[model samples]
Target: LLETYCKASGQRINHEKSSIFFSEGCPQVRRDEVKQILNVHNESLSERYLGMPTDVGQSKMGTFKYLRDRVWEKVR
Candidate 1:
């Protein structure tokens, strides 16, 4: 389905850079199956986007330490 959509839209997906993130309670076998089907690798919650962890919940400020550090560095 993804391939078909990409073909129809003339857009190419870079599978090498793509990944699948499973929920905490997701079975390993099911996660593996999804990874295989999507042709993407597994990614941990620590994975970052734009220098910030992407999996942090809304109330988790510890994950934003990197952002704080960057701000401090800029302030100096």
Candidate 2:
């Protein structure tokens, strides 16, 4: 659908700037299939979304430490 829209509209999808977020319950096999369909072989996912961390796995604080550091820098 997105590819069709991009082609029709004459716009382009910068695959480097795209990331796919799957449900927690999604299996690895399914994820691989979806990636194959999307042709998103780039393993390096963008770590931030709109200036916030995306991969906040187990440690939200650890993942968001950069934000805190930025705030401190401005205050200092």
Candidate 3:
């Protein structure tokens, strides 16, 4: 089903780079993967960016440890 969505939409789905179905994390590799996802998706990673923007960082940002929290939110 997911494969079909990607194929029909002409979107390349990278499971490894995609955010976890539930949790978040921000390891070096995962960060890079997320960056790749954003770049491919042409997402903006800015604080003002609201809702689930293409930039996962903005969407996943947490209360403390802004940077790390954002990363983990996407990875975990």
Candidate 4:
């Protein structure tokens, strides 16, 4: 999902700095410009997942590991 999002958006996540709590990464597209796009979407993406529950026993650790790798890749 993250890969697809990154590819389609041309944005990369900086994992070395990104925490499980916050979404931090380079905006391939400009903030001012992207905000307009997001505004149109009305924050649906964040609203959908921001407070969703997760299962520690079932969720794969690799999901987060992959995000961390991508974050460093973009930062580099």
Candidate 5:
């Protein structure tokens, strides 16, 4: 389906750089199945996207730690 979409849209996707992120509490088996179906590796929920941390709902403090650190550094 993704390949078909890319071909129809004339957009090529770099699968090597692509990753699959699952919601919290997802079973490992299900995650593995999804990865196999999409041909992408399983990425940690803590991985950042566009400079902001992903899965912030899982750990608000951990996810925003980067921002807090930057703010502290600036204050110093």
Candidate 6:
């Protein structure tokens, strides 16, 4: 699917450099299947950008944790 998108959009995807961040409850078997299909490594929650979270679980708070802190900072 991604390969087709890349071809249509003229964008290149480096499988070796790509990483997939699955939700916390995602089954290991599913994760393994996706990793195998995409040829990208599975990323852990530790992998984040600009201090924001990388993993998005069933708890919405965990995904938007940075926003809560920012909102509190503004209120002060």
Off by over 4 Å in 5: 58-76
Candidate 4, residues 1-76: lDDT per residue as tens digits?
Answer: 6678999999986644342321346363554455453333222223224433332335656536666777899999
The CA lDDT at 76 in model 6 is: 100
Segments in model 6 whose C-alpha atoms lie over 4 Å from true places:
50-76
Best by TM-score: 1
Report model 2's TM-score to 2 decimal places: 0.52
In angstroms, give how far residue 62 of model 3 lies from its true place. 13
Pairwise TM-score winner, candidates 2 and 4:
2
Off by over 4 Å in 2: 42-48, 51-76
Model 2 has an lDDT value of: 0.80
lDDT per model vs. reference: 0.81, 0.80, 0.53, 0.49, 0.81, 0.79
Local accuracy of candidate 6 as per-residue lDDT tens digits, 1-76: 8878998999998876667778779999999998898888846556566676665558987778779988999999
What does candidate 2's lDDT look like per residue over 1-76, in tens digits? 9889998999997777666778779898998998888877554547777787767899988888888999999999
lDDT by residue (46-66, candidate 3, tens digit) is 443343433354545453347
Using Cα atoms with residue i matched to residue i, what is each candidate's TM-score against the true structure? 0.61, 0.52, 0.27, 0.27, 0.58, 0.56
Better of 4 and 5 by lDDT: 5
Ranking by TM-score: 1, 5, 6, 2, 4, 3
Give candidate 6's TM-score: 0.56
What value of lDDT does candidate 5 attain over all alpha carbons?
0.81
Candidate 5 total steric clashes: 0
- The clash count for each model shown is 0, 0, 8, 3, 0, 0
Cα lDDT tens digits for candidate 1, 1-76: 9989998999998987787777789998988888888888846555777766777877677878778888999999
Cα displacement (angstroms), candidate 3, residue 44, comes to 20
Error of 2 at 16 (Å): 2.1
Tens-place lDDT digits, model 5, residues 11-76? 987778887777679999998888888888847554568888666676888878879999999999
Using TM-score as the yardstick, the better of models 3 and 5 is 5
